[model samples]
Target: MTTYFHTAAALCLAAGMASAQSADVPDNLDKLSNFQSTGVTEFTFIEQDGRYAEGIKRTLERITLPDGFKIELYAVVPDARHMAVGPQGIVTFVGTRKDKVWAVTDRNKDRVADEVKDFAPSLTFSIPNGPCFSPDGFLYIAEQNRVLLFPAAEFFYESPDVAAFNLVAKGDLVPPEEESFNHTARVCKIGPDGKIYISLGQPFNVAPADKLDLYNEWGIGGMIRMNTDGTGREVYTYGIRNSVGHDFHPVTGELWFTDNQVDGMGDDIPPGELNRQTEMGQNFGHPWFGGGTVRTNEYKGEEVPVEVVHPVVDMVAHAADLGMSFYTGNMFPEKYKNAIFSAQHGSWNRTTPVGARVMVTYVDAEGNATSEPFAEGWIDENDEYLGRPVDVAQLRDGSILVSDDLAGALYRISYGE
Candidate 1:
C-alpha cells in the first residue's frame, strides 16, 4: 500500500498536471477511467484554514452524546456514504454517491486515520454507494447498475489493480430503458443465510400504474437475495420506494431496513420508516401508504394487492433515513447492546431541516421496539446543517464510525471517554 506522505506529493503533482490538460478529456465512462487512472490519489482534502477548523471544533463541542461517550474527527473523506470495515481490521472501505470509494487506515492504532486514499483507483465507479464484505474477505460493491466482487479485497486493495469479477454485469441490475437517476442509490449486505442481499430503489416517486407490473417483475422496488456467485436470484421483499440501508438481526437473523417516504406531501404528515421483515416475500407499503398507514395522493383509491407491513418505528417526516447497522459490540454500555444505530441524512425539501443525527432503536426480547435520539446537534440553532450523517458502521474495537457527506468527513464515536 502507498504510504501517506508518498501519496500526498504524487497526488498534488498529478492534480496540477490534470489541470493543464483539461482540454483533451475523453467522453463518458472512458473519460472517468482516464481521470481516475491518473496518479491523483487524493481527490479531496479537509479544510485546514483557521476559520474552517475553528468552526468544526465549535460544532464538535456542541454535539451531545450519552454519558461517558465522546466523538472525534476520524478522517477527511469526500462524499463518504456507506462503509465496510475490513476483516483484518486494518482498513475501512467507504463508498460514495459519486464516482469514488475511499480506503482509510489507522496505522498506529490511535483510532485516528493516518491516511485516506482512493480505493481501486484504476477503475471507474458509477455511484458505488454500497460495499459489503463476507466473512472470508470477499468484498462486493453495489454500483448504480452492476455488482462487482473482489476476492481477498482486504489484502489486495493496496495495489493499483485489484482482481475483480462482475457478479451482476452492467445493464443487468435493472432494465436499461427503465433506469432513472432518481433514487438510484443501491445498498447491499450479507445475510445470515450467507446470501448477498441487495436493495433496488425504484426511480419514480410513486411508480406509475403502467410501470408497476414491470417494476415488480424486475425486482426494481424490492430487495433481492442471491448466492455469493450471483446465482439463485429471487426477490426477498417488495413494495419499497427507496431503501438505502438494511442489516440482518444478530440473533433472530431477520432483515431490518430504513425507507425514505414519498415527498411532495407536507413537511410533517407522512413519516419515514424503519421496517422489519421476518419472512421472504414480505411487502412494505410504498405507493398505497406513504410511510405508516397514511394513504398517498396518487394511489389513495387503488386496491392493495399484498399485505402492507408497518414499520418497527416511525421517524419524523422528511428525515431521509438512509443507512443503519445493529450494535453488537461490547464497547458501549449494556443498554446499547443489540440496539440499532441508524442515520437520518436530513431533509432537503422541508422548510426547517430535521434529522442530521444518529438514532438508536431498542428492541426487547418480545420484538417490541422503541427509538430515540442517540446523537444530536448536527442541525444548528439557525436550522443549517453543520454535518449530515449518512451511514453507521462499527469498527473492530467497538467504536462506531459515522460518515458525513455534507462535511466530507468521518467521525468516530466511542464510549467510556
Candidate 2:
C-alpha cells in the first residue's frame, strides 16, 4: 500500500478549498496552496499557447540525428537546468536557474510523463540549478548558496510539504561578500567515494589578483567536496572559470566536466573545454590560460603561479558546453558504450552563433578522446536559437532526457525506437 503523507495538503488544493489572497503570487510558501492542479498531464505535448508547439514541431523537422535514433517531447518544465533520476526510476527531479525544482513522473510506464509539478512548493528556492541522488535514495539539491537534502524525495514529491533538511545553511556555502548574480549555477554529484562534489563558479570573467588567493582557498573558482553530512569541506579541483556539469567515469572514476570559456574574445578563439581530473588538487587554468593556452587579457604577460592541467578536448569557441553524462546503459549501440554525451547551451557572445546541440565524446580505453556532433539543428539557418540544451541525463531504461530552458520543455531521446 502506498502512503500519502501530505494528503491533507493535497486534498485542500484538489478540492478547490484554498485560494491566494494576493494578486501576485510571491516567492514563498503561501503560493503552494494555489497549485491545486499539477498544471499539465504527462506525455501530453505543451504548445505554450500554440506558438511554442509550432516551433517545436518545426525544430524537430529540421533536427538531424544518427540512424534509428528519435527524439520526442517529455514534459513542460520552466527554466529546467540539471536533473537526477530517482533510485526506483519512478521519478525525475529537475532543478532550474529560477526558484523551483520540478518533479516529473510517468505513472503508467508509457515512457512519457504523467504529472509535472513543483517538488516543494512551500519552500522558496534560490537558483536551485543542480539535483543529484545518492545510491540510497537521498536527493540533494545544490542551490546558489545552500544545499538541501530530501530523504526519499522520489516517493514524497507528490505532496506540497515534503521532508527536507539543510546540509549547507544559507550564506554558508561561500563568503557573503563573494556572492554574485553571475555564474552562480551550483552543480552537485555524488562521487564514487560517497562524498558530495559541487562546482562553485567564479563570479567574474577573469578574477582579479586580489581575490585569486582567497578563491583558491575557499574553492570558489573550482570544485569542492564534502561528506554527505556536510562536514570536512575541502577543495577537490581548482582553476576553473564556470562548470555547469560534470560526471564520474564509470570505469576509471576520474572526474570529467565542462567549463565555459571567457567571453569577449574573438568568435573563433579560446575554445570551450571538456576536462578530466585524475587526482586531487588538480588545476584547470582559468584567468591564467583562459580556455586552452589562450592567455587572458588581464594576465597576458604575467607568469602563471601554478601548474595548469589542460582539457581533454578543446571544443568550438563559445560553444557554452554545460551538462554531461557517461553512457553506461545497454540500450544503445556498442559504439555508444562508455561514451560521454554533453550539452552545448549555445553562445550569445558570438556574432555567428554556434552550438545549441548535443555533443558526444568517445573515450578510448587508453584515455584518448574524440568528439563529434550527435544531435543538432537547434539553431536555425538564421542563427536564431530554437532550443538551448542545458543538461543531459540518462534514464533508467537507457533513453536520454535533455532539458531546454529556452523552450521551457524536456525532451526524451531514444534509440532503436
Candidate 3:
C-alpha cells in the first residue's frame, strides 16, 4: 500500500494483497476489496443495443438545440446524477442518488458508450452522488457520510474489485445524525489550486438560527476544500441552502456554483442562484435571502449579521439548476468560448414545468453574466417530464455530456454532428 491509501482514520483488519482493508471498511467489503469474490459476480449491466436505448434515442429527436448542435444518446445510466470525465479519457465515472456508481467506457472512440456497469461493486456506498477526478487521474467519490478515493480509476475500473481507500472515513463527511436523503447529493471538483472542493447541503428548508453556528462549524450549508489526502479541511464558502453543482473557473480560478433556494415560497418568489466566490469565507445569503436579493420568510425581520454576496446570475424561480461546467471545448463557435453550460433539472411542484433542459451562461469582461436556454424539449405537451437533467460534463474530445436521472441516460451534445 502506498502513502496515498495511508490515513490515520482508516485502521484496517483484513484485506486482499492490494485491497484497502480498514476499520472503516465492513466485513463484507473485506471480501470485495480483496478481489476474493464473495459469490457476488453477477453485475447489473445496462443494455447498450436494445429497444430501451432506441427509445432514449427517439426522445433525443424531440430535443431542440441551437443551430449546428445536436444531442444523441451516449449511454443508458440509471439515476445518473453527477459525472466526472477521467483525465485519461479512458472511462467516465458517473454517480447516482442511490447506492451505485457506474463506469461507462467507449473503447471504439465512437463517442457512444460500449459498456456500462457498476463501479467497485465490492465496496458499499450510500448516496455516492459526486465523482470528480484529480488532474493526475485519481477518482474521489463524495458519499453521504464518507469520501472514498480510487487511484487510476480510469485504468483500474475494468476489474470488479479495484484498489480503494478512504479519503474521509465513514460518518466523517458529515455527522451521521445530520444525514438526510433529500438535498444530500454532493458535487465535487478539483480546483485550480490542486485541492478537492466538495459541497455540503444543509438538510432543511431553512436552517434554524440555533443550528447556524453548528452548520457553520461543520460546513453543512457551505462548500469545503481539502488536500487530496484529506487534510487541511476548511469551510471555503458559506450561506447556501443546497448547492448540487459547482466548478472552478479555468481562467480566474474562482469557484462558481448553483444553489437551490427555499421551497414553499410560491412558484416565483426567490429565483435560483448561480454564485461566484472570489475569495474564501464569502457568505451567500441562505436563511436570510432565499435566493437572489429576496429574503426568506423565516428571517424576514432579523438583521443579517454576515456580509452576503448576492448571486452573479439569478435564474428562473423553481427551475432547479443543478450541475454546470465552463465550455473550453473547440467543437463550438467562438461565441461559446468560456461560456458556462448548465442543466435545469426542472421543478418538482411548479404550476407549469419550467426547466428540464440545458442552459448557457456567458460572463462578460466586466464580470456580468447572463443565461439562456441551450437545449430544450425534455418536457412534453402534457407537462410531464421525459428526462430530468442533472450534471454537465465536457469530454476530452471537445463535445459535452449531459446526465439525466429521470431518463437514466447520458446524452452527448456536439456541434455539426
Candidate 4:
C-alpha cells in the first residue's frame, strides 16, 4: 500500500526511534564549528516547523534495490553538496551553504560515519562545491572558482575544531591568463593515472557572450586534466556545458561524465549528455550543438563555423543527472557488476520535473549507455520536492551511501541474499 506522510510526521517518528538508540546529536549548534568534540554523530532527518527550517523534506521512504538488500540512515549533514570518500574510509563532504568541508569518521567500524568533524572552512571562497581525492592521496577541494589541495594528514585528522586541520597547497590552478570565466570551476576527480581532472561550468547559457567571452574563446566546456601536483594542465575534452558527476569506467577505463544542458531552451530539444572521454582535447559541443545536430542561434557569429561534440547517450532533457558511480563491489548481483547508478536531482526551472529519482545507466560491454529509473517517489504529484540526491559512495561492506542535501540526511543501501 502506498503511504503518505508529511515531512514533520515522518521526522517525528524517525527522531523518536533514533533518540533511544543514541543521543549523540550535536548540541543544537548553528554549524559544525567544533571538529574534535563533535566528531561522533548520528544523522536524523527531522522537518522544521518554523522559518529557520530551510524548506527541505526527506521524501525517500526506502532505498529500493534488488531482493537481498536493506537500507538505513547513516548521518545527516547540512547543505551537503558534493562529497568524496577517500581511500582511508573517510567520509568527506562539502557544505555549500554552511561554508565548510566536513570529515565524518566510522570510528565504530559499523560501516557508517559515527563522528563528524570539519576539514576545511570557507577560508577562501563564498562556496565550496566539489571535493575529491587525488590519485596521490591528497584531498582536493574546489572553493568556488579556485581549487585547493590538502594533505592526507589534514584530511584524516579527527579533531573537533576547524583550526586543527592543515593546508598543503591552495591556489588557482586555472589562472585568468590561461582561461577566464566565473563558471565556478571544480576539481571533480583524479584518475588512476595520477592526473587530476576538473569540471568547468558555462558562464552564460550560450557561448561568446560579450560580458565574459574568454570561456567561449578558450573552448572551456568539458573536463581538464593535470598532474597531481597541478602540472601539465590540458583540456581533457570540450563541449560539456556543466558536467557534475564523473568517474572512470571500471571496465573500459574511460572517464564517463554527466553533462547538464542549457535552460530556457525547448523542453526536449537540447537533451543532456552522458559522454565517455576517449582522448584529450576532444570536443563535446555545447551552445552550438544539442543531442547531436539541433544547433542553436547562439553560434550565428561563428568565426570558423563552429562544430561541437556528440554525446554517447542522451538520457533525457532536464533530468539533472548528478552524482554517479559504477558498482564494482560484489555486494550486488553479477548482472549489476560495473553498472552505473546516478541520481537525477530533479529540475526546478522545467515545467515538468524530470529528475529527483535515482536511475541506473545500463552500459553494454562496448561501453554504450541505456538508462532506466531505479529509485523513484522523490517528488509528490503536487509539484513539491521531497529529497534531492547529490552524491553516492560505497562503504567497506559493499553497500552504497546516497547523500540527500535537501533534507540533510545520508542513506545507505545494502544487499544480502
Clashes of each: 0, 2, 2, 17
lDDT of 1: 0.84
**Which candidate's lDDT is highest?**
3
The digit string of per-residue lDDT tens for model 2 on 1-417 reads 112222335424432421332223343333333334433222212222245545565677777889999988787666678999997999999998866688888899888776676777657678899999999999999999988888778887866666677788778898989989999999999999999999999999988889998999989999999999999999999999999999999999999999999988789889999999999999998889789879999899998888999999999999999999999998889999999999999999898989999999999987779999999989987889999999999998999999998876788899997
Show where candidate 3 strays beyond 4 Å.
Answer: 1-40
- Candidate 4 segments whose C-alpha is farther than 4 A from its true place: 1-58, 62-64, 95-98, 121-125, 153-156, 160-187, 209-213, 216-219, 300-307
* Pairs that clash in candidate 2: 42-113, 42-114
Higher-scoring candidate on TM-score, 2 or 4: 2
**TM-score for candidate 3:** 0.92
Q: What is the C-alpha lDDT of each candidate?
A: 0.84, 0.84, 0.87, 0.62
Models 1 onward score TM values of: 0.90, 0.89, 0.92, 0.78
**lDDT, candidate 1, 228-281, per-residue tens:** 999999889999999999998899998999999989989896999999998998
**How many pairs in model 1 have backbone atoms within 3 A of each other, for residues 3 or more apart or on separate chains, i.e. clashes?**
0
TM-score of 2: 0.89
Q: After TM-score superposition, what is the CA distance of residue 383 in candidate 3 from its true location, in Å?
A: 0.5
- The TM-score measured for candidate 4 stands at 0.78
Which residue pairs in model 1 clash with each other?
Answer: none
